[model samples]
Target chain A: MKTKKHENHTYIIESEDMERKNEMLLQYIKEKVNQLLQIMGTKPLRDEELNDESLIAIDPIGIIAESFEQVLDHLKESNRQLQLARDYLQAVFDTAGVGISIIDRDLKIIKCNEKQKELLVNGVSQIEGRHCYEVYCGIDSPPLICPAIETLEMERAVFLKEVTKKGKVFQIVTSPLRDRSGSISGVIEVSMDITEKKRALEAMCQSEKLAAVGQLAAGIAHELNNPLGNILGYAKLLLMEQDTTEFQKNRLEVIIEQAKRGSSIIKGLLEFSHQKMPVFERISLNACIELALRSLSDEIRSNNIEILTGLGTVPYVMADPKQMEQVIYNILLNAIQALEGKGGIVEIKSEALNGSVEVTIKDNGPGIPKEHLSRIFEPFFTTKPVGKGTGLGLSICAEILKKHSSNICVESEVGKGTKFSFRIMGGVTGNV
Target chain B: MADKSGINLDVINLDIRGQICPACLLISLKEINKHKGLLRDGEANLIVKTDHRDATRTIPDAAIAMGYAVFVEKKKGYYEITVGRKDEDQKA
Candidate 1:
């Protein structure tokens, strides 16, 4: 009888321990649910009260255990769904070319994809948790025209806005984020680096303006041609007169020279305005360059610039010979001008590589500045002071080559020299 | 047998498909206009192929916006819309 009583006592203690464990688990679950509600930005649920009908005369242990089990199951299922959604979203973000970022209501970057990180850090570090303005716009606080804040307040998507930061332009769009309860939660910003696009647009605008100017120049040149011919004809007539004095002859000669200069200027303007379409024919590029050099013999000799020709045997290229000659002439003239009355070596080399003919014209003159390198092919962009350079030389050469589906690339180092390489499509001679 | 009251007119046929957006719908209309003279003369038809179902439902609305009389029909996997002169539809 004594041992039986001890067994009962032991059973009671063990049962009490199990009940306490159950209560502790319920408390833990309740705390976790509260935490989850806080994360989801929702109100927490109230615990069972003594006067509550749902809990009236109910066994607290059973109720707590069953509720905790249900909560656990729900959390597990929700966590699985959340993980799947996160994976799908991450996949979309990674594959999208445009940069994307999510900012909380506080303007702190809550999430950012690879492209966003690439644009903000230039392929460097992670940008998560950083303030959007500080990291991207380099501002301590958000700007007055903050798209993210506006999107959140208006609860609507905004169109792309062009913004410049750190000398680079970006096109950014923002959309409001809504929670399950249809409340605005945050903002999603999509940005694209539109600097190159903007530059291309500006270039096209400039090209259109140049085209208009070319038309005007053509008209002016046509009108000036007739007067120039008259002046030249009269000057020659005066020079041939038998009764003309030495002073008169000298004056006539000066008039003739000025008229010739004006004629040459008109010719250049006509060439710029009337760019003939390239008529491609099979021709040896080496022969063309050699002939161009021969044509420039007088100018090259007067400048005392040494001309070195490394004319490698190249495959015949289908190109307009006259246009190619003009291209070479412009390059050689530019090289001579860069020397600025000083003598330097101009090397011309040719090679056939990878189904293309590469012709390089290198000059040992004061090289172009780094900033001016890209703008060299832009119309009217010249380093030479006004009237000294029309700046159409390189631009016209580029256009001519571009018509032949060819390209010209320039590489220069300050104080060193400049090398211009022209690549043309080679004729397929049945040999790869 | 004094007079025949009912008169039938020929129906114009036009097919447009592969419409993914409003822009595509507009482009299809522009393409149809290439045969506008023939349609006016009641000689030729406009045919297009599209793969978007939502755009099919929206075609009538688009036709209304352009002040066109259109008849829409649904086949197994496509929608065909006919747009032409209103008086020429009496033969259908």
Candidate 2:
């Protein structure tokens, strides 16, 4: 009986211990579930709604796990869209027509596109992470017109209307790239090549100036021509008298000679101002060239200049033969004068091409200067001494060719030579 | 039982009109757990109509987290939150 009593008490104590452990484990589970609910941004779990047994049965952890999976799905979708946007922007940045470059506040180049490389960067040169000024402007330091500095200093967009770099004109626009907090971190530079546009504008201005000068020249020439002719006529009439002294005869001859020179100058001005429209006819360009050379043959021979001709079998071009010969004469005379009596080669080549006859006149003499190339066809723009030339030679040639539906071109180097080429229509189809 | 619609639409409605935040959340979760399989398979919809204002916010959030579509409707004096799939509103 005593052993039975001891065993029963021991069994009761073990049973109580087991109940306490179970109660503690249930409390721990409740606390953990409540913590998870709080993290889900919700109110804590109520003990009344979920007793220890019900909480375990519902498996709140599993519910929260599935909730997180949905959240993950949404996040992944957002990331995918963001990546697509980034790729689209990158494509636009690369294929833009104008040069584009990205630079940091320190002026270090971050990215440069294909046009930027073509416009500013040289082949096989490293530019990434280097100073932008060094690569773009080819200088050790930033230039006074550096748009990067302007953008950083102004903290806004900067547009430089005209910038000359690498001997080409550009219009530069720079915009600041700011971070989320609105502080500038870098800059985006856009450069457009406007070199051709600038040259075209200059040519337009030059033509306007030429038109104004031509009008003034015509007015002066008109006012002086009548007086000059009368002076020459009276002086010649007095020279014919028999009672004149030798001294008076000498003075009359001088007056007549000077007046004739003045009249010739006036005639040139009138011809330039009122350039006649061509009376088109089927004329041989070779015949025009032959006549011009024949007229200047004495000068050509005296200067010891060699005439090299490669006249191909070309058809007759529709032009005014008189004006065409005049054009050839002016160009050849200029070439002879350019040789300065030092014997040189003048190549005359003609060919039939694309239903047009193209002619080239080249001289192996001291070429025109680099700066005077564009102004060579302008009236009265002369490099010759004041009394030596009238300065209307090339300009008048240009005018005559214009009437013939063609233009003149001259290419010159300082020490080498000059080449001039122009084309006139020749095929039967061109006649219509 | 067939309603006036004459289709056997399974709708379980829990009316906790006087409840507040946490109690509303716990009761909604218990009901959702009880019918998780039915709700996913579009077989049943769980409708919890409560007067507690916070329940509208909390209940819908928790249901959506559990991968169930939820719609909340405000009636005369109480907010009703429905948690299920397609045709859940028509069934309610």
Candidate 3:
């Protein structure tokens, strides 16, 4: 007999270890035979050579080993599934368009996704483990009314709110991250960039205010028309009476001139506030522009401002022909005024782009200052001196364009030039 | 002919202070038209007391159109508008 120890396990086998492979098989058979002897309904059988071709009875040890293997396989499958779920959640967090961040009760960021990093840091630095205020507001401390703090204190979710920080607008929604027992542990903050939306809302509000003022102007103008008309009529009548003295005649002349001025002012007011129900028809934009220019032909000629047109074959737009002509006339007049008699080129261009007909009026003159651009559409807001302009021309243009479901946008640079562009959606069927 | 002086006694005065536009002008015009016969005869003058600034313009303009000479005097708290027909001023 030979004995050997390897890897802390003792092996008893035939001297040639390869020939003793069936030693465990013999032990398995012995255990089975002993079990059969204990059962009253079984008959004991003699043991013979146990070869690969011979079938051995099922053993208790073999059953235990098979069960153990199945349990291990199930654990591996569960681990693989759990790993897949984690990867899927991570992908969603990273690719979400809105900014998302997780912060601890200390207001320190624990985790943040790509959009959060881009919005807060402008893609400059990784923001994890830093203070939330420093990343978001560029401040040392969070404001007292911070939504994250509010959520933590209330232990509930906070609704989305618009917040302006660092000259940008964000819509913030905060929720309390709680433990299993419902105790708040941290906060999850989601934010979306809303600066453009905020600007549009402000523009809409300004338009509404201008509309109200325009309506008031129209009402006042209508009321004054009667008295103003009477004044002019009577002044003319008095002047025609062949009065005795020239003094009365001079007074009458003055009265007549002032009354005419008042009438013109009323005319401007009516133009600004008049909201006629639009009679929609497909009209040629190029024809309207040419007509508006023809009406201002005298001013254009006297001022020596060149009228250049690039009227491409644009499809007709759905609009009231009369009102749309007014819009074109106002823009062209504005361009001429910007020239200020310096004799520059006023270029008009119309084309079809992206399912809309766009008309652009460009002037090579002293451009409007940047600050005044935003308020140019407001009624009575003017750069012209008193008695020169009623300041309602552009506003009336805006009102008409708004009725057509369009908007006017201006781009200008001081000392360079200015361009005003408006788009009217093209009508279906291409022509009337 | 014009009376550059001011409103004196013997003129019919209608006070319209605290009344807002259009309304003030309406009432003032009504009074002036009521005295049309006397005004044409050079026997009566019409004066209106109104605080509405717009009435100062509207009333005078309306009166002048009806063959009357109008004068506006801005007082301490309101405007005093006096109107007389051209014939009355000529007689005075």
Candidate 4:
């Protein structure tokens, strides 16, 4: 038994009575209501009745039950629509051609598209949560001018003109990602592969430089010719005088030889400057190539470079024989030099294709770097050390090929090799 | 233009601006030859100013070849060449 005292009154309660009172008389009432609910078997309790304690407390009888049911139904429909929108956005993200990535403020890649995975990370799985600099640049730290870093640091959009990574060029744009509070959270990077565009820009710049150099060379060569000739003639006259000592005669002979050499260089400059037009004639390219190869037979033999010539059915083209020979000779010399004296294979293949004669020169040697490949055809641009290269050979070849209505293009992969290819249109008679 | 430098001597001023190469050299030579009498007596000097780069080399070389004492001074965008006969003392 238990006794509880109140103001001016006392009540006695037995333990059995207390237990009966705590047994929840409301539960019996709930059972009676459930029996009535069983008549409507398809109706489930509203979510507010089960999980929302606050709503249950505010309205014990569920006076707002209908309203809560309608609200829950509306929320369900809105969620379905939102899920559909999310799926549509996901499809667009996956199907985009350009590489797109979202990076967190800590420079970790949070999300990337299919193109980003394929082109940037070399199709590596599990790129998410990896550091962006490590995946894109292969460096442990971000480069000095990384667009993502700049966007995050400056809290603005940043654009990079051209960035070369893994031997491919890309135009990158990055913008800051902001949270609902209007604070930057991360950066979104969009990159487009622009290798072909970069190559075109390089070619334009190279041709401009070549033109300026040619104009200057032509002016100087013309002025130098008269002085060089006067020097040569005077030296010859002095050499012809019999009343001269042996020492004096030797000096005059040396002067004459040097002046003659200068004259030859001036002649080459004139040709390079396009002052002399090539006299075009229908010629067999195979024969011209053979003649040029013959001229370098000794050098090739000494260097032990294996020459593989694959001459297919080739058509005759309208070309200047001497200039064409020079072109072949220059490209062959370049191929030999690329071998670096360690001895490698030089492949020369000529074939007729697409109404033109195509020539390809491939070498298994140290390949050119991506940075230098663009400027290789520009005059005075060379990778060789000082005194080892004149830097005019390829420019001259390009000039000659341009005159023949053809163009030279190179494909090189670092540490693999280089391939130079050109096409020259055939004459009026296809088989001439 | 001649001035008295505490001595009665003559100076000839020749200007060949906007002239190119050998023309500037040739004109400077003509002026030097015209004052040859004063030059021989060591009574005058020839000063020629030209804005041609080639003339800087050609005029000096031609003047030196013709047995004249030449001095070249480069001014802003131009050259001043002074020519005189070898002094008797210098010849000795």
| Runs with alpha carbons beyond 4 Å of true place in candidate 4 | A1-63, A84-97, A105-107, A129-134, A138-161, A182-184, A218-220, A244-254, A275-280, A290-314, A332-373, A383-390, A403-405, A409-432, B1-92
Return the candidate ranking by lDDT, descending: 2, 3, 4, 1
lDDT of 1 at A78: 61
Error of 3 at A357 (Å): 3.4
Worst 10 residues of 3 chain B by lDDT: B1-10
User: Which should have the higher DockQ, number 2 or number 4?
Assistant: 2
Q: Please, what are the lDDT tens digits per residue for candidate 3 over residues A155-197?
A: 8889767776666789899999988997889999998989898
Per-residue CA lDDT of candidate 1, range A328-386, in tens?
98898898888887899999898888877898999989999987987898777789876
For candidate 4, the docking band is incorrect
lDDT per residue (tens digit) for residues A268-383 in model 2: 77877777788888888888888999999999999999999888878878898888888888898898888889999998888888888888899989999988987888888888
For every prediction, compared with the true complex, DockQ reads: 0.01, 0.19, 0.00, 0.00
Comparison by TM-score, 1 against 3, better one: 1
Q: How accurate is candidate 2 locally (lDDT)?
A: 0.81
Clashing pairs in 3: none
**What's the TM-score of each model vs. the native?**
0.59, 0.65, 0.49, 0.57
Per-residue C-alpha lDDT of model 4 across residues A61-165, encoded as one tens digit per residue: 232233234335545766898999999988998999899999999999999998887778875678889999988878898888788888988899999888878
lDDT of each: 0.72, 0.81, 0.76, 0.76
Query: Worst ten-residue run, lDDT, model 3 chain A?
Result: A37-46
Residue A173, candidate 2: Cα error in Å is 1.0
lDDT (tens digit, per residue) of candidate 3 on B1-92: 01122335657778878766544554565565555667656677887888878788777665654556788899999999877756533532
